[model samples]
Target: MQNNITIRGAREHNLKNISLDLPRNKLIVFTGLSGSGKSSLAFDTIFAEGQRRYVESLSAYARQFLGQMDKPDVDEIEGLSPAISIDQKAHSHNPRSTVATITEIYDYLRVLYARIGEPFSPISGKPVRKMTVDQIVDAVLKRTIELHSDPKEIKKRKGANHNEIFVMAPAIVGRKGEYHQLLQDFYHDGFLEARVDGKIVSLRDRIPLKRYQQHTIELLVDRVPLGWPIEQNKGLQQRLTEAVELALERGNDVVRVILDDGSEMLMSTRFTCPEDGFTFPEIEPRLFSFNSPYGACPECNGLGTVDLFSDDPCEACKGARLRTEALHVFINNRNIVDVTAMNIQTSLDFLSDLTLKASDAKIAEPILREILSRLTFLVDVGLHYLTLDRKAGSMSGGEAQRIRLASQIGSRLVGALYVLDEPTIGLHQRDNARLVETLESLRDLGNTIIVVEHDEDTIAAADYLVDIGPGAGKHGGEVIATGPMPKVLENKESSTCAHIRGDKQIPYPKKRREESKTFLE
Candidate 1:
């Protein structure tokens, strides 16, 4: 394999027939006076060629969606790999796009929450869980046994030695309608009877209902007598299973069991609160995503704000950007919103210290690992101060670029060329070492990194340096020196070498300005 990127007669923008060989799999810095063709060489010529070659390799049908790139104005370029450019441009301006989402940490987080999250009822604040057919059947059988043992409860029944119950499906709840057509449809569908507003009525009869008044209707699925030993009876259990399944299907995941003693129980195949009659849909990864319609706050439509360009949070979700149901789901006592509300470092700490139930931990191991890796990468890029939910558009150019860099590192792709623009910009001096280390890590992963940077620290950390210019624009675009740091610094023609070598310096102000006493107030 070719170990160097060979370029000859590369003329793009202000570049004047520039040609050079950049080493592969190394941290190479392109530093010079601003507008001295560093970008023209790194981005326009090299990265552009790499991208165009990659796009061309795709199928003709796939190429239509990507659109064709106009080949750069260069001749005889070789040894180019697939390239990705991480520029100082916001990847997305959409308010819903955040650091976590961009890095795909939120995607894994969503799956993790959906798999192990415990949902609590908003009304009762009790853990809500979906009931399976076997579970509901078992519970009903237990209730039948208890009822049969109680003579006082059985005394109310006329000439009955066993407990009797009705398995029904609630077709409508607190709905104001005559329901004439609904009854006719059920009657034609072979349903003989229905419980209308707490009274059993034959569906064949013309049940009078006030159209303006609220009513509840439950279609009778089956009537069973718990006389014989039901637990040992296989035939009875099979019948009960069919009835429960039918009831759940008609009731939209809920089934109601009514006893002859006037007591009732609501069973569901969904996460439901028995006391409040609240039912949640099936838990899935999409439910935790604010971008999904099923999970987005209804009041703000998932934007986290009711009004535009204002700090006023949505009254419903309180800027959590999700529905009340989604917010109510928790893992280790923290909801997805609560987790995303924390900064990167805080979130990393929380995840590192998070304790899960044995079963839940088993299910969430891979997901947690992925989230942690991405978070650590963000921290490595000197972005520990940003929140997971911070809008990507709100980040500064340098911060946004670093976010993309962190995401690239997390992707773990190899043998690709990565071009970065001034990753050290907007970063504190204390955090510069961490950022440089991150670049080094990427280079060590067998990928070539070409960074167009002006920071002396970043320049000094490069394994190879290509200093462009004697001056900016027309007088520039020519490589003054290209080699390792010592070799570049020794070159007399390179203007950047003088500044780096301390041959010249920006002197401090001759005199400090006096503090002004005037106040606007």
Candidate 2:
């Protein structure tokens, strides 16, 4: 394997038979005046060749779907690797695309929350618990025993030897519209009767429920009497289990058992609050994903903001992009939406202090590590102030470029040629050092980095420098100098060296402008 990228007779664009050897696994900068063919050489010639070669290696059928590139006018090249370009292109314009979505941090967050997040009641603010089949059955039996054991209650109910119990599955509850299709489903599922709006009616009886009015309906599974010697009745327990299971499968994880005395008991096979009858949907990755129906806010459809004449925060979810139920679920006293809304630095600090149970720790360790690493990458690239919910389209060119750079760093791919265009275009002087360090970190990972930039700080930090011009446009394109930083900085023929060696300088203003009195007005 060659240790250098040898390019001979490259005449792409304005490049005039430019030939050079770029050392592999090093930070190389291409510096020149604007429109002086720096991009033409780094991106068009070298990176383009690498991409074209990779695409050509695929099958003809596969190539039809991919964009084809014309071969560069280079005579010969060696030691080229697969190339990736991180430019100033925005990732997406869709409202659904956020910083977390684009970098895939949200996906990992979804999985972590689903696995260990504790659900609380939206109404009562109490921790919800899921009841197993045995727990549900035990509760029912205990209630029956307690009622029969009360001598005063038993005497008041004269000749009431039979305890009437209605075993029912919730078909629909508090939803608008006449559910004709749902009624058909209930009848087809072997239900003979239904309790519609608190009225027991036969399935054959056509009850016209108002289409626009909210209603509650339940399928009558069975009607049994809780007489003496209830333990001997095995058939009653079997029927109870079947009804509860059907309700859990068909309903939103709840079943209602109405007693003769007008009291009711709610049973659930999911995390629920018995007091408020609040139940959560099954825990899955999609439960935390705003893009999914299970978690998306109904008002804004997971876009977080609403378009009401102008863009505004959604009233229903208040820009969280999740339903009230989802907001109730917490991990370490913070919900998923709250966690995603935190800025990168705050999120890192929050995760550092997070504690989980021993069992939860085992499941969350690997996922948490991946999330922290991606967050660290964002912080390293000077994006610590941005939250996960910030839209991708709202980002500036430099922020978008750095985001792509951070993603590449997370990939940790080796033996690749990375081409970047002005990654420090809008960065502050203080932040430039962090960006430079990030680029050096990529180089240390056994990959070659070639940047097309005019930043003096970037050029000064390069391991190898390629100055492509003595001037811009018609007067440029030929390589004036190519070597290590010290050698390039000392080249008398190179115009780039003139500025670096203090021979030329951009003049500063003699006097700074003062703020006008009317500026605030």
Candidate 3:
């Protein structure tokens, strides 16, 4: 009949007969100094007990391999839901786990892009100059050279044949090198002008290009011949088939004599080769190469950005700029040379002071802003001034920790508990407010947040606060206070009471911001 979750005789770690009642579905923060058994009570005790009980509930066969959690020293607990924990461990891993990849938003976006994107051909459009009407008419009459390789041997079933000739043309023709060369030499210099129906054209006079379409640019022939051979020269097969059917103007079968090139052409409606029993497959347009202009953007390969050599480092860092393994112990994400690159000196000196509208370097203002914006995400998450290309492997514990946090900060999940650890450890006083805002927003989403924190800023934002330390180690573990923010601070016996009520210096405001109040007239 207790009002909420009854945790009676929870002797987990420093918890001494901790008969506590935790309200369901509320933000409850546990606070105390380091080693005050905050993690022991939350992690080693309640979470451990929950896991043990859940696993125990499963069949013996299921529990055999899954292994239940080792029992925590706890008597009883009620009204416990499943738990989710996110610890502060820097996963300096492969870029395979980037912000886009982790949140899965990139995958979703890819589906949207591929489904609705403009499916332009990978090839560029080349130029086709305006040809005079006479010029185009002349071009149509020029060399009607066509060649087809012999059909494969297996296509000899003699089934009704459906041979057709097709020319592959560009979807959009423009002035490219190949098309220009076609007009040069061949338009006038070659024997085409004479063969093109006596329609002579000079490069000088302006003739309308409309005449080009008046004559056929390309033609197709389809007819069947009875005496097709079973086998022949592989290259000469199709030509012979076309010539035979073209030359025979009787019985809907036409055959033509071979051209001097030792090949037959497939033109005119009448044509079938000797052995005429095979059907051919249709050919479709193909992408050259997605990576090459063949199929993708030459600049970004459809990825939208190219990697600059500078952005990718030398092989030493594996292009990471940061060495793969830090041989010596560095205090944080910074090593000796990182000292130079991390231009912003301290937590207080962070970029927030740098105006989005101001700059003082050789780089242009826009460029500086771009650089700072990306690097600032790292810093705002306590990763200031680090280059965008900094390899993940060399990131410090806190730097990597916060970087992972950044990837998830934009999650669309509205009501999922985001249990955070000491989120303010590496952050300076200025960053505490940002951290506080992040937690408060998560709490506002109806999630039951439970933070094991030591930061004063994080502690103050909680809907309900629990202090589990009156001393350290064995001397600690008792619930010193559990109540609303103000009431917890008012508790005479709470260890955190003095920390909040105690006089502490607050930082000077960056700028005294006061909005003008509108008065109702």
lDDT of 3 at 159: 24
Error of 1 at 461 (Å): 1.4
- Model 2, 1-521: lDDT tens per residue? 89999999998888889889999999999998888889989988999999999899999999999978899999998999999988886467777878887777888888888888899998999999888876676667666666667636743333232466777778776567888888877788788888899888888767788988888898877776665676656876777667667766766676777665545677777786756666676677877777777678989878777863447889898888888878888899999878888998999899877898999999999999888988987887789999988888899888888877877887789989999999998787888888999899999999999999888889989999999987777778899998889888788988778988989888999999997777553
lDDT of each structure?
0.87, 0.82, 0.46
Q: Rank the candidates by lDDT, best first.
A: 1, 2, 3
Over 4 Å off in model 3, which ranges? 1-3, 50-67, 90-95, 116-395, 399-418, 503-521
Task: Give me the runs in candidate 1 sitting further than 4 Å from their true place.
Answer: 132-241, 246-270, 307-311, 514-521
lDDT by residue (tens digit), candidate 3, 1-521: 23355678888767787888776556678887677788887777766665677778889999889865788888888766555555666464653233323323223323322222222111221111222222321221231121223334223222222332211111112112222333333345321221111233342333344323322121112222222232333333454343333333321221222232222322223111112211110111112112223323344432322343224334333322222122111213232223223433332243334322222323234433443433444455545555433445566655555655555554434544345567677787888776666666555765556788877777877778889878888878788889889888878777677757874445788998888798778
Q: Residue 291: error of model 3 in Å?
A: 17
Q: How far is candidate 3 from the true structure (C-alpha RMSD, Å)?
A: 21.3
Count: clashes, candidate 3 = 31
RMSD of candidate 1 to true structure, Å: 9.2
Among all windows of ten consecutive residues in candidate 2, which has the lowest summed lDDT?
154-163
